[model samples]
Target: MSRRSSRRSPAITSTSPCPCGLGETLGETLGECCGPLHAGSTTAATAERLMRSRYSAFAVADEAYLLRTWHPSTRPARVELDPAVRWTRLEVLGSTGGGALHAEGTVEFRAHLTDAGRADVLHERSRFTRVDGQWVYLDAL
Candidate 1:
């Protein structure tokens, strides 16, 4: 197995609320943060939570989590989250906005994965939204 995502600073603050924007409480987010593995984060803790959860969704093949955390309009009901893929690491390039109560935000991230023992990359520019006091992932480019 690869190094745990916790190798760095304990990704999520055991006390801060998650930044996935899924209308879930701190307790709920904590469960996810401590469970299944995901990608690493840099800079802000909220951004880390978002990145880590996305990785967890991928690791566990939790299509629902992926969709639920995803901003509705641009999100799909179901996706074939590949199970054979093994994610290596995540590099958060940059993040902007999405602060305060309700607003829009964007996160640019680089995800590295290994498929069939071959390395691959997913460089995406993702969008996010804070609705009803929750941050939900929108879509990625």
Candidate 2:
């Protein structure tokens, strides 16, 4: 197992609401509703799922998982999570492709966040690619 897996944080509980606003209780604390993805399972089955998991990663400050799932072509050497920012909600506006047979996909979303008591929203259309049978975040479009 990798160091990331070994150091999995125990902050999230099984009954906690997913930070991505998936409306599902985290059955296991693996990724707080995206456990399978963060646990090194196969790529998310859909673009929306990948998007949600990524949002949850930001919410929980899982920089390792974010980097692991990012496409190598565009992935940065390091990811820095802002402790002062608190992610509040996620709204998946739409998605295209990103299925069992597709190699590429796009997900549009708006994430609500608060930083230093100031509320804000982040909107973007993200691209994704399947690499070696796993979904990886490419970039924002």
Candidate 3:
């Protein structure tokens, strides 16, 4: 396994409620809640769902998942996450496209986090695209 896989934190469990606050219980493992994106079993059906899973990936420090769901054209070979940063909450502002019939979409949201005893919020509008039938993050707008 790579360092990123080896460092996969065990902070979240399957039974734990989704960190994205979607009021849905996780599956048998952290990958279950977002298994489609993580395991490639199926692509996220909607842009909003993709965005939620991405947020959950950050909360768990699953760099692998983040990379897997990222568009290859813009995806980096590897990702380095700040261990000190704790993603606390996600508030989705809105979304467009990335639906059953659309191949592209955009999701806007705010992510709340705390790092080194400092709390901060990240607001962004993210773009997504369908690559080989999977919705992958393209970039921030």
Candidate 4:
């Protein structure tokens, strides 16, 4: 039988400072606010928060967080944000639209991961929307 990979790894140690700059450790930073998004702007701010949280989810394989923030239309029925998928970096190319209560925004990022001792790159241009006063992931290209 083929052996599938485990999707949850041991928690980060105190000695390890997080690469995302959220905190000294992974668990400590999951919900910690990093940029302006932490305070709540209703539009751009929430989008920013979602972006950061998604990255954090990728780093820790927090599938629950991913689903919670995803718009129902685009959210996958199920996701395997594998813990074995070693996240390497995150970058926000540009963002726009804080004018209306209901608005759209874009996030372009490059995610790096390693699987089976080999590396892979996932580059995406993602769309987000403000729904019911929260930012939700819509789709990714």
Tell me the TM-score of each prediction against the true structure: 0.63, 0.83, 0.86, 0.69
List the candidate numbers ranked by lDDT, top first: 3, 2, 4, 1
How many collisions per candidate? 3, 0, 0, 0
Task: Tell me how candidate 1 scores on lDDT.
Answer: 0.56
Candidate 4 at 77: error in angstroms?
2.0
Q: Give the per-residue lDDT of model 2 (tens digit) for 37-113.
A: 76666557777788888887777677888988899999988877666788888888988998878999999999999
- The 0-to-1 C-alpha lDDT of every candidate, in the order given, reads 0.56, 0.77, 0.79, 0.59
lDDT of 4 by residue, 1-141 (tens): 112212323563223444354454345443343322322322235565477667755575556556767898887776765545677666556666533454787777676768766798777888888777678888875
* Candidate 3 collision pairs: none
Candidate 4: lDDT over CA atoms? 0.59
Best by TM-score: 3
Badly placed stretches (over 4 Å) of model 4 are 1-8, 11-31, 34-44, 98-102
Candidate 2: which stretches are off by over 4 Å?
1-14, 25-32
- What is residue 57's positional error in candidate 2, in angstroms? 0.6
For candidate 1, write residues 22-111 as lDDT tens digits.
Answer: 314445553445333232232123534555577555644555556656667887656664445766666677877755533777778777
Best by lDDT: 3
For model 3, residues 21-72, the per-residue Cα lDDT tens digits are 6745433344456644655676678888888888978887778888888899
Q: Give candidate 3's whole-model lDDT.
A: 0.79
User: Local error of candidate 2 at 26, Å?
Assistant: 9.8
